[model samples]
Target: METESFEDKGGWVIDQQSFVVMNSSYIMAHGMGRPVKDAATTVKFPKTGKYHLWVRTKDWAPFPKGPGKFQVLVDGKSVGQTFGESGSDTWKWYDGGLVDIRNANIKLALKDLTGFNGRCDALLFTDDLKFTPPNELEALTAFRRKLLNLTDKPQEAGRYDLVVVGGGIAGTCAAISAARMGLTVALIQDRPVLGGNNSSEIRVHLMGDVDKNHYPKLGRIVREMDNGDPGNGNPDAKEYGDARKISIVKAEKNISLFLNTHVFKVEKENDIITAVVGRDIATNQERRFSGSFFSDCTGDGTVGFLAGAEFRMGRESKAETGESLAADQSDDFTLGTSNLWASVDRDTVSSFPETPWAMQFSDEYHIDEPKSDWQWETGFGNFNTITQAEQIRDHNLRAIYGNWSYLKKNKAAKYGKKELAWVAYIGGKRESRRIIGDYVLNQMDIQEGKFYPDGSVTATWTIDLHFPDAKNSKYFEGQEFFAGTKHIKVAPYTIPYRCLYSKNIQNLFMAGRNISTTHVAFGSTRVMRTCGMMGEVVGFASYIAAKYKTSPRGVYKDHLAELTGILKGETLAPQP
Candidate 1:
């Protein structure tokens, strides 16, 4: 049985961030070092007898011992051995010995031993002791489907003029802009909410200026959904405007918004994408969406990657990109992800338990702030923002909890009344796979204010690159959680439309941080409002492509003038 499908989740939260790498969404016990309440469910056995149980879990921190230890309870009885104490880092099945089942209907529960981000993917009970579950993701997926009676074929979701994957600020703007221009659009989001980092789940306020670009009306749609500058990692949930964003998308009659739907498969012919397949996060039911054109706004370039689009993940060498800001040598050193958190002052003093399993912090070396903001970040250098996402998030959580514990213990007088009000589980990612395009935007293009004829979206943010703070490194070393940034100011430069569509994939368009930009140029273009404008350009380009029956490249080569006119507030077609 899938642990995520438990009747009562209790304190365990559904984490789908690493679903791409892990293959399935798992439940995490994020009780801040305290043991979380049991996640209980009822299951029926085929026959009443002795059964061997296998639990799919991982040792998140497998150094000395796994901190994420948990037990599987059958009818409120322990399943012999601890599940997450296998000492292996990868996700594997741990033998839970055997349990005698007297009744067909029995109570099953996951008892979290220590709340240091313990996770459970699924569980299996077999009458045959010799049988073992598949460890490989592909084989395991087939095994799960056959066991659960899930169909291999996906249900049709309907055809669209444009299919926009990811419901972040960029994807939202893309769908809204296309819908306003009379395109039947499908906007798919993996999360329950519309906004990504800007959503209440992450609470990062929107950055970059809107409506200050060459194209005056380019950011109008983005401005309509703007939640104002609430600041990063704000404790107030209402400040980020989740309802406003969803309502605006729902108001568009031409757009079909799919929330909690994660697109994982892509169907292509020759070099053009034909359809994309997604699975519902809760039900695991797959749906297929066909479109004339597709947009990869998934920040990680998920759709593009599946469609065989050429992409880059690490920073380019200075010799290769001819940018001074580029790294000395091309390496896997992309910007990190942030899991921001905050604390609140309470009327009564609150006590926090010491987290011995977490990263130990002393009075001399600890973040002495009441809350976390952008500075509290992780996943840099060797750490991959995609494959190692869960580890990065857990590392950030360790830092937050460990630092809070230190503050509470050392400076009781100052922090005794403070309580952790909010902590973001969904990571605010900065850099990942950058889908290659016709013209790659570089650092010199932004710094020297270089102009292209097809300049569509104006980027106003600075070339802000983050690195591990020297002070933080002194304490945490290679596992540093804190970050420092150097913002290099630049004149507002228009990003070329050539950077918006894929070079190899015929009909693929991109926006957000995953746009065709060097690691250095992404420092400026990664902000939400700038990405929103990129989406606007993609939307207009999609209209031109649909109208003229051309590819994204065809729009640039032939219908450039028409796309520019549409961007400049000249309505090409009436809203349907």
Candidate 2:
């Protein structure tokens, strides 16, 4: 049985951030240093007899024996051996010996011993002792499908005029804008909620000014969904407004919002996209959405990458971009991902166990804080944010837990009553793949306030680039958990409409941090409000494309005036 499909998850959380690399979403017992509640489910055997048990898990930190140790309980009885201590850094199956079944239906549970982030992918039971589960990702996926009785064909989820494959602030506004213009839209989000980083799961507040845009009404949809700013890493989940974002989307009659759906496959003809396929995270069911135009608002450029769009992942060299902020020699260095955490003060003193497997902290080395902010980040340099996402999040958890443990032990006077309130399992990512478009905006464009005939969205944030904190590097060199930034202020500048749609992929449009821009220019335009305005511009462009029966490039090259006029509050009716 899949551990993530447990009937009662208890204190475990579903982690699907690295599903592309790991093949399946797994449940993690992230109880800081304490053991979490048991994850239990009931299963029926086809035949009551002796069966061999196997569990798919990993020893995330194998040094000095894995700290994330757990055991399987059948009817509240131990299954003999402890799992997650296999000494293998990668995911593998652990043998749980043989068990005699007296009843057809029985209760099964996973009991975590030391919750330093114990994880389980799936469990298998078979009467054949020689039958071993596949260890490879591809083979494992096929095996899972066969066992779960899932079909190879995906269910068709009707046709649409526009399909937005993300539900962040940018995608949310894009769907709303298009729906209001009479275009049938499908807004797909991987998580259960609408907001991506700003959602309650991540707790990052919205930034940038919507009222200061080139077109005053460009960010109207964004303002409609705005929850009050509660600052970054706030412990109050309601302050982030997960419900408000969903309610706004549900009110749009022309939009079909699919939450907990992750798009992984793209259907294309020649250079244009025809349909996108997504799988439900909980049900493991797939659906295909066919659309005339598509938007890649996924911050990682996930849909764009799957559609084979031209993209870049790292910084550009000074010689290549000719930007003053560009690095002397470019490498694979991009902004890191953050996993913010918070602790609350209780009336009575609280106790936290020691974490030897976690990163050890000293009085001088610890962060010495109750809550984390934007500065607490990881995954820079050689760490591939897409593939090594799980490792990066685990590293952040270690930092938070280790530091808290140190504070509880060494600095008890101030932190004795403090207890971990919330820890973000979903890593709040900043940068990844930037889909290339008709024009790549550079730093000079913003600095000189260059006039492009198709300037649509206004960007007001500074050219802020983050690096490993100098003090943090002294304690943890390569795996620094803290971040620092140098903000170069710039005048509010307009972003060209040409930078919103893909250059080669005919029907693709992009927004958010994944828009076509150099690393230096992206620093200023990556904020949410700027991204929302880009979505507004793309929505107008989509209407022009549909009315004129043209592509995104045609809208820019031949009908730029019409698109600009629509953005300036001129009314245009949708074609029947």
Please name the candidate that would achieve the greatest lDDT relative to the true structure. Answer: 1
Off by over 4 Å in 1: 34-37
List all candidate RMSDs to the true structure.
Answer: 1.7, 1.6
Error of 1 at 122 (Å): 0.3
Q: TM-score for each prediction?
A: 0.96, 0.97
Q: Residue-wise lDDT of candidate 2 within 7-28, one digit each (tens)?
A: 9998888888888887678888
Best by TM-score: 2
Worst 10 residues of 2 by lDDT: 567-576
Model 2: per-residue Cα lDDT at residue 528: 85
Q: Write the per-residue lDDT of candidate 1 for residues 68-171, one digit (tens) a residue.
A: 88889999998778877666778888887888999999999999987777899999999999999999889998898898677867899999999999999999
